[model samples]
Target: MDAQLKHGLLEVCVLTALYKEDSYGYRIIKDTSPFIKISESTLYPILRRLESGNYLSVYSVEHNGRLRKYYKITDLGKKKIEEFLDGWDEVMNIHNYIVTETRRNENE
Candidate 1:
């Protein structure tokens, strides 16, 4: 995938994960693991970017004598997700065209 596009998608994915409830880093990674395997290295930078963008808010809570930072999606972040979803049909159209072209070439 294109790096820039992948970055934006990942940002939206993270936002969706926090849509229902606030989550900590480890839990977010674990929850999203089924679809994407994100390591701590990748997640923290994304978190920082989201925080800086005001897409989410971060707060530290005491967990087992340590501070665990949790992320909550903001209205702007929710709108970002909605915006991405609004364009889903175009992406599906492109995907279908690529598949059809690839299969047509194979049958030639």
Candidate 2:
């Protein structure tokens, strides 16, 4: 996968995951891992960035006597998701066009 593509999609993916429900850091990592291999260290920084940017809010919750920080998308985050969706559609369309053309040429 392209590094630029991964970087572009990471924020959208995180926000989309939270769109499903509020989740702790670990759960976010687990859920996204199947689709994208994300290191905990890398994910933590992105979470921090999103929180700092006001795209997400975090709160502490006690589970099994351990305090975990859960992240929830803010209204601003929802707006960002909308913007990303638009960008995602454009990127996918371009990618599909390029791939389809390549396949057609290969069949010639």
Candidate 3:
């Protein structure tokens, strides 16, 4: 996958992970892993970028005698998810076109 495209998808995936409930770093990775493989190294930067963009909010909670950061999707983040869903048809159209083009030679 293109790094830029993957980067955007990863950001959205992280937001989706927090859609239902706020979560810590490890849980976010575990939750998102089913849809897309994400390592700790990859997750932290996405988290930071999302936080910086005001798409999500971060708060520290006491867990196991330590502070663990939990991320919650903000209104903007939720809106972003809705927007992505709205634009999904366009993505699917592009995907369908690519698939057809790739298989055209085989069909010939």
Identify the leading candidate in terms of TM-score: 3
Best by lDDT, which number?
3
Q: Candidate 3 residues 1-108, lDDT tens each?
A: 788888879989999999999999999888888789899999988888999999999999998999999999999999999999999999999999999998997799
TM-score of each: 0.89, 0.84, 0.91
List model 1 lDDT by residue over 13-62, tens digit each.
Answer: 88989999999998998888887767889888999999999999999999
**Between candidates 1 and 3, the TM-score winner:** 3
lDDT score, candidate 1, position 74: 96
Consecutive 10-residue window with the lowest summed lDDT within model 1:
1-10
Q: In model 2, which runs have C-alpha deviations exceeding 4 angstroms?
A: 100-108
lDDT of 3 at 68: 92
Q: Write the per-residue lDDT of candidate 2 for residues 1-108, one digit (tens) a residue.
A: 999889867887888889978998888889998998778888888898999999999999999998989999999999999998778788899999999999999999
lDDT agreement of model 3 with the native: 0.92
RMSD of each: 1.7, 2.1, 1.4
Please list the residue runs of candidate 1 whose C-alpha ends up more than 4 Å from where it truly belongs after superposition: 1-6
Better of 1 and 3 by lDDT: 3
